[model samples]
Target chain A: MRDKTILLVEDNQDDEDLTLRAFKTNNISNRIIVVRDGAEALDYLFGEGAYAGRDLSMMPTLILLDLNLPKIDGFEVLKRVRADSRTRRLPIIILTTSHEQEEVFRAYESGCNSYVRKPVDSAQFRDAVRDLGLFWLIHNVPPPESE
Target chain B: MQTKRFAGGLRIALVLAGIFLALASGYLAGIREAQMKASGPALTRDLTIVLFGQTLHLRLSLSALGVTIIFVLTILLAAAVLFARVAHRRRRQVEAVNRKLMREIGERKRAQDEVIQLNAELEQRVAARTRELQTANKELEAFCSSVSHDLRAPLRAIDGFSDALLKDYHDKLDEQGQQHLQRVRNATQRMAQLIDDLLSLSRVTRTEMRREEVNLTAIAREVVTELRQIDPGGNVEVIISEGLVAQGDARLLRQVLENLLGNAWKYTSKQPAARIVMGTCKGRNGKPAFFVQDNGAGFDMAYASKLFGVFQRLHSASDFPGTGVGLATVQRIIHRHGGEVWAEGSVGQGATFYFTVY
Candidate 1:
């Protein structure tokens, strides 16, 4: 349990607060890192900029990405993460407000692990977040590391 | 131009005549001089002449006879040369006219070809512009959807916190305070519904359509079954026409039936023994029209024009609940298939919606 961590990259403050509350309500109980935009997310992931000299071995177990963001959008962040050999196997789930089929297909085609829409109904949103945590944080197995 | 050409020909003819007369006179003068200067034996010659009723004999000068014969030959030769020159000039003028006509015909042919080429180019340009405009329209629709989608986040927050206040501090709030919170929650939810409905309306227009032979009868059967499940307590009867087949997009046609039949189910909720019929009949111009009719709380005919407008409802929200987007969507789909839709009913007399797919 102590080994798992989740990174949330969302720009909107309201959405960030709601997502945090939903995670807490579901008893996810993992180390959660929040970044405001795409550029900050990259810095945190690559241990660069403000995160310089941080231990790169402690990688996030899961990534929740919002497609609409400032300073490089979600697709670019997903691309750079997958391109790096050190972080290619991390699970990247797209969490956004759009349920359009074209956008969903595009997310999967660009190598996202899962796609989920942020429902306007808060109770439904909590249930979706809980199911996501149950699957990724506990039930599913992660690839073994060199350590 | 014709008069000028004729005048030119006349001037040449007159000049040739003057030269001919001058030459004849000069030859006659020379003949006279020769006859006057010659001896009698040289100038004279014996001659015999025969007339209609008498004969005559005379002696004539040889030189005068020779001079007369030479003068006659010279006159004839000059006349022949002059006629030939005029004929050659007339032939050249005719050739010049023919060449002008040929040049005119060639120019007209080139101009005609240029026009045809221009028409083809214009058609190509029109097609390209139409495609560009279609692309721009699609982008605008997408932008509208995005803005509406982003609006839901704050609304969810408002509704969620209202629930929080109600759930966490139930005893701390007074009755009026609780009611106010409930109202706030309701308004937020309604706004969310509006956003969803708006997105769907735009989606229907933007979606691509595929035409095939669709068994609308079967689709209606499925929609009615679903409606029955939703409103199981109502004792509503549904009658569907057999073999209602048409050419259209199957998915979109299914949506049309759902909206129409769903309305039929919803409006008749107050009836004790409700009857809803889905059938085909002859419409205006004798075209086959499909209709969904119900013995429900029908609306006044005066407000019929506003029935299909977005969020427009003839009945009060308390009486009947709807987003009023269904009929508009139906109209769009049918119109896409080159069809028309209309309705007919009076107050409390039940309503029938008729639509044709061309």
Candidate 2:
């Protein structure tokens, strides 16, 4: 678990900092990799563009996805991830600030494992992160490695 | 009107002329009879000289005068009877036509009255519908405030950075500074909640309703389960009757139950043995009604009317944290279902919300 990596796909810098702070305060010491947009997230996942020539077998333990991003949006990324045999079973969780039910339903429909809203309250946000880390990082067992 | 009068005058004049002609014919016949009587003596003298087998000439003249007088009187009487018969027939025809005209006029007047009455009724209906539309328009305007996307984006920025500052720089700030930042965060959160609620209320109005058979019992159970998850320690005894169903937009009805049950959960937090019930009952108007009753922080009856208005609150935020838009949203949903919702409660007792869906 300590050697596992966590990928964060987000565009907003403040949100990224807040999420990083949440992880640090919760004592989650897993390696967190940040990508600024959906395109970068896909590139990192598929070993293309800037992430080319990287080891393909070293996939992240968990993916924290944001819906609103530049170049490509999160839903498309989720679809592409699910389509590929290599990353088909990756545990992807949607973390967004949007409170729209349509967007939430769309995220789930696109094959996300969990959906969490980024609360405006800092305390609530911290608690949400703590609970998420405890469950996904410690308690829940992931799928087997891809052959 | 003028033409009708002229026709009536012409008919009267034609009848009068017929009567006058009859009288004149009678007068001329009388004159001819007198003349024949005056010439009788001359005729008798002449006949006695010419015809001697003239012994009977005086008797023959007297007999011929008698016969001539009788024949003239019979012809005059016959003519008078024929004229009288013609005049009587014409009079009867005129009376029949006049009776027909009178009946037609009465029928036309009645038809005109019916048209006017229908026009008045149409006007009244149009006015009533216009008034209803105006009221709905006003409500829409109130719900759709001018602060849309532009306002919300800046608010998000303020909230996000303030949170960042508080979390990242907490050790640098004094106790007073920390409290100030916390207050700022709280205000921003409250403002965000208000904006979200207003937007949701407007959405309820704008969206079209899709009606389908919805199991209310299942929806209520789901909402209660979610509520229990939120407040797992609260020992609220929730009773939901089985097989309760209605026809409405499933999503919107779910929202209604969520708001109602969420309120029940929030208000009943203080009660050690809180009781909540969701079931169906007969409404005051004898319609099937769904109700949510809770032994919670019930409000005063005097302020009940304000419960469903946007941003209208009977309780303070210190006691119960709310944006005061949940019931307003519920009312909008019920109304969209062509239904009505009302609440009944007393201070320090309990509250029950009743609604009907058609």
Candidate 3:
């Protein structure tokens, strides 16, 4: 439970299930901690609301965020996280169903480390997840903790 | 200088006086003959005289005949003058009528020229507007291309990373964990399709149209074949009447068929057996018309007006996958050909699109 974790911020249940499956298929060992919306994801990350009692020192290795949500969308969440001293350098990946050009550029402008679009074919979906998990887990080194 | 009416009155009066004079001359001749027959020594004159008691009058020989001769000469002069006056008045009236007629003809000619000039100016203005619209369409197409390029970058990253994640982690994830990965991939693919449709709409509007005689049947058949490739399992029968030709841009006509027939294929995916037909008939304007009829998931009649509007979709995204640009593109193409396009459908029954390039 204390090992490196993944913060998956997604609204749709089906998409959330698929992400979990992608991680498993790719053989990633990190524990996936999912929130249903951007607000909940922030709450969990900052140890606020229901997660007030949770330990703040247990930081996740990566955050996968969806752009569109019920309230407090991913851009606001990313901005808030980057502005704060404690979680400014946290690796945030934008994983959404939107392929709008403005959305991609905006995500990068707002300090997201990476962006991803969902795929249709199940096999192709599985393959994309496999590659993504491998690259981040094996190739990319996590940034150091902020002061 | 006498007025024509005054001169006419003078001539008539002179003519009456001459008639009396002629009668007097004849009477004088008669009296002279009678005198000669009676064997008179000398016949000097015949006269009738009137006098008062203090006045005396003498009659001269041949005095009546002299007066009659002068009277006849004056009457002949008056008659000639009267005829000339009447001729002069008639000539003046005729001249006035000719001048008025010429003026009226000139006015009508000017009005006709002005009308012709106005029509030419209106045509020039319409040409200018068409050019402006074409330029606007080009700009929109450029914008769409840029958007598509920008959108594709992130999509690639999404698919790439998810694949990496699934590849590097397998043993640790439970069955529930595995399902989440699949959903992420599905969403990305749907987004890519929407972007593609946006690009297609932009392309259709921007491209310059080259019109020629096009075979509608060939386009329909080709589109049907393409649709079958996309949905192999979906059973749909397509009937196309061969050799129905029209004056239009071939590429645009092909796009129109693709959109209409493609919609047929997509909507009829749920049906056990689908029927689609393409044929020609007389249009509402009594012109040659083409039609695409399909038995599919048709839309509500109330929302029919929105069918050709950009991004206006009647069905939900979760049910029917589209960016809602196909029919809009089709409409634009048909309109550019100087033709008309319309659709008829009811919920769950079917849809038919009719177009004419007259």
Candidate 4:
């Protein structure tokens, strides 16, 4: 069991499943908590609404965000995360289907760690997930509080 | 001078009237004196008769003078009043017409100035909007670059891992496993191509234009010659008019011809004796219009509106292999040159694409 946790905030069900499947196929067993929209992702991070009973100290080691969502959107969620002292330094990668330049600029402006586009093919999708999993899960050293 | 003339005539008439009136009064007084003298005379009847005749003559002359004076005075007074009224009316009419003309000129000037001001404002607004659009396009291109770069990393991984699987697990897996890996590679390749085409299309928007006088005829002939060299089997006769000069970016214009000619070649594959004509024609606005006409498998007229849109393909993938950005890129190039392009075609007939380089 990996000690790190990943929060995958994606609106599309197929995308969420594909992400999970990629991790499972790559043998990356990090605990990934999936949220369907930006609002739920914010809730999980701030320990509000449905996640009120959860412990605030055990925040996710990494966040994979999608720009388009049902409510709140990725930029707003990122802004809120950066504003909070607990999650200010958290590694947030914007993994979205939109290759629109404005979305990427907005993500970077809101203090996102990196931006990535989702590939169309299933095989390429798996590979992208594997590289990210290897980098964050193994090589990258998380902060002391996250550990 | 006019007032002096009028006053002189009035003074002459008044003096004549005064003299005539004085003569008439004197005649009347003389007649009375003669009558009194006749009453006082006791002797000389013949002398009395002579005096009476003299008095009668004087009376007749005085009556004539009185009548003449009244007629002259009335005529002078009437002439003076008539002249004054006609002069006043003529001056008033002239003043009214002059005021109306001046007002009309002022109004026309104001209207023209307002139109000029509105036109200036409209031009300013258009310039500002064009700048905003340019900025947005630049940002979009940047985003496409990021996408292309990031997407390539994953594509590399997919092709690499799949190849590894094929090399290592060749003995363990059967024919079906090899086919699956090949499919994976093919899919990755197609995806890569799509991304690359998108990147190219985005790049077309940002490339700075280098403008110069280009001989479109020479370019068209060159493109056709190249095509002929590649495929010697096609019996396509190319007619290119010479020395057609236009102002444009040479490289971009060359690309435009390449795409258009390349399309002509692909569509005319079925015709045994294909006739391709590249020359200049008169445009809608009386400008020189360059055209590439070919006897090929032309598209339907209904889908002409979609020809310039990015990734808009009229033909199926099986019929034609392209990212559907050739005509779109052509349009962008011509549009950058401040020109326009349009295509005319029928379902089973040939197509002619015309463009203007302004």
Question: Sorted by TM-score, highest first, which candidate order results?
Answer: 1, 2, 4, 3
- Chain B alone vs. reference chain B, TM-score for every model: 0.67, 0.60, 0.60, 0.55
- Summed backbone clashes in each candidate are 7, 0, 55, 0
Q: Please tell me the TM-score of chain B in candidate 3 relative to the true structure's chain B.
A: 0.60
For model 1, what is the alpha-carbon lDDT of residue B190? 73
**Candidate 4 wrong stretches, greater than 4 Å:** A1-3, A24-27, A83-86, A121-124, A137-147, B1-94, B97-173, B177-181, B188-192, B195-331, B334-358
Pairs clashing within candidate 2: none
Model 3 lDDT tens row, B199-272 = 66766756678978998887788888888887788788878887889888898888888888888888888888
Error of 3 at A135 (Å): 28
> Between which residue pairs do clashes occur in model 4?
none
RMSD (CA, angstroms), candidate 2: 12.7
lDDT of 3 at A123: 62
lDDT of 4 by residue, B201-259 (tens): 66566767788999888888889889999888888877777887889899789989998
Off by over 4 Å in 1: A52-59, A79-90, A135-147, B1-98, B113-117, B120-128, B131-135, B221-242, B271-276, B345-350
Q: Candidate 2 regions off by >4 Å?
A: A1-3, A138-146, B1-172, B199-218, B232-243, B268-279, B294-297, B300-303, B346-350
Scored by lDDT, model 2 comes in at 0.83
Please write out the lDDT profile of model 1 over residues B45-91, one tens digit for every residue.
77776778678776755544555465556556655665676677778
lDDT (Cα, tens digit) per residue for candidate 2, span A1-147: 336889999888777887888899889988999999999999999999999998888999899998878899899999999999999999999987765655678899999999987777677788898998899888989888855
List, residue by residue over B142-229, the lDDT tens digit for candidate 2.
4343334334445556776677777789999898998888788888888878887877887797666899999999999999999899
In model 1, the Cα lDDT at residue A124 comes to: 80
